[model samples]
Target: MDQVVTQKPHELLAETLSTKMAAVNTLIQTRMASEHAPRIPEVTAHLVNAGGKRLRPMLTLAAAKLCGYAGEDDVKLAATVEFIHTATLLHDDVVDESGQRRGRPTANLLWDNKSSVLVGDYLFSRSFQLMVETGSLQVLDILANASATIAEGEVLQMTAASDLKTDESIYLQVVRGKTAALFSAATQVGGVIAEASDTQVQALYDYGDALGIAFQIADDLLDYQGDAKTTGKNVGDDFRERKLTLPVIKAVAQATDEERAFWTRTIEKGRQEDGDLEQALALMAKYQTLEATRADALVWAAKAKDALNVLPETAIRTMLVDLADYVVARLH
Candidate 1:
């Protein structure tokens, strides 16, 4: 009989950080509540309970503890980070017209798009309230800037997505804006609230920035390679939606005129038909873009691990290092 692996490092991190995470969870529940509008909590609860990894908020809490913080503000910051993330998900579903997330019906599918948008706005307001309680001007500035960057990234994607002209630089800008901005903010604010040294704070920011890049790249790669049951997403979902993620971007860069026409019709003109997805996958495989994209993700993961060298070593730090590895490990 084969022996079972008891837990992963993140599971252990969660166990070690259980007490603080409980406080963060309580704060999230309390803040997500709305006195006048019952619909706010209803929609919020649906998504909040959807079993995400809570990795962004966990980054905030882990950074604070790693920096030797013992105050209550880390909990508030963690909850605030979660609110910001949840708000983005709600808004993203509306934008994507997505029907499912975390293997369940998205809030927009269950409720009207207007309700999802309004509740997402309410959560953003709640996040601001929590940030003000932290009372750090720098922290507020970081989060505020991250929020703006996220919106900008989404808008950029709207214009650039499906356009073969979008190079890797534009793709990276969108990734940094949509994903890494919040991640960097989460870790940076944790160090700020802890009064960590400038070098340590910068190190945390770098770690998160690289980790977020790796994570999003892995996700994009998985769209072509992953099982729908495991990924909780339909394979070819990006293809069907005509979103030009990294692997497709690489394939596009090397396309023949014949291949380019296929992309133009399906992605640019949105006239997808039977075998389009299979043909698209064939182009990616022919270009070896999926392998190239995986290599890129591993590079960012390595960068994240390297960034951690600036911080003092601790159990939490080790777990964070492992967490970075695990983010890309999903690709294998």
Candidate 2:
């Protein structure tokens, strides 16, 4: 994918991150086999072996190393993070009834929903086992709370579906619970495992939370503005599904009486027709919700950088700051 900021990844940071990610990759390859059933292995490997950016695991590794950790548990934690992310992807595809992901057929689309869901469960259990191997109750608590938050976020989004009245406060909470919780926990636990000072620990947690928030907001905004080839999914998929995202919520608040009536009839009532796509695009542009959401993303990204002040300025910390900017810079 084309990164939108900082002239692609810096060479030094890319090499440093790459070395850490290699260890994570090895751990995943060695541990992600199925013991109970071979079919589980087949299904798990389909997505696990598929090329992903490995951002989550890299976050874990980067946080650990930046906090001066050089132990084997970090490897286990890195693998745990990747497993959790992959399991979420499986469950997400099932929930969204998605056909494509990362330019490939989704597991639920390639196989049946049964394979996707059950294999997702298997991965979840395996991730738990891997986390337990770390032997840190705090790590377990952090990830466990994150998993619950993620589920709550999904339920909130489902309940809020097609509701035109969903406000910015509710939207932020949903994005935080669904996306930022895991990112924060992954990085926070890395600091916890490294036994960083409380101040350092809080800084890492805040940094991850802000980074995740910015990233999700950017993702939602780019759904309308980005190239389909770059984003690896259909634009207007959120609109077609009648999901009320940040851009739509902001646009609704800014709509005129006639525009509000149109939204109520189409978006709220789920009465999309053949030309709904063009109509939604025009409405979004008319309200400038895209620009508003992007501003929110940049705000959180700046907060992410601010949180990094407690830590000494290392290359990794600088890289993390740059990466945070990259997430919000997508809209530009």
Displacement of residue 228 (Cα, Å) in model 2 is: 0.6
* Tens digits of lDDT, candidate 1, 1-332: 12214567678788888999999889988988888999999999999988887888899999999999999999999999999999999999999999999999999999989999999999999999999998999999999999999999999999989898998999999999899999999999999999999999999999999999999999999999999999998899999999999999999999999999999999999999999999999999999999999999999999999999988899899999998999898998
Backbone clash tally (model 2): 0
Q: Where does model 1 exceed 4 Å of error? A: 1-5
TM-score of model 2 vs. true structure: 0.94
User: Which candidate number would show the highest TM-score if scored against the true structure?
Assistant: 1
TM-score, model 1 to reference: 0.98
Error of 2 at 229 (Å): 1.0
TM-score of each: 0.98, 0.94
For model 2, the local distance difference test gives 0.84
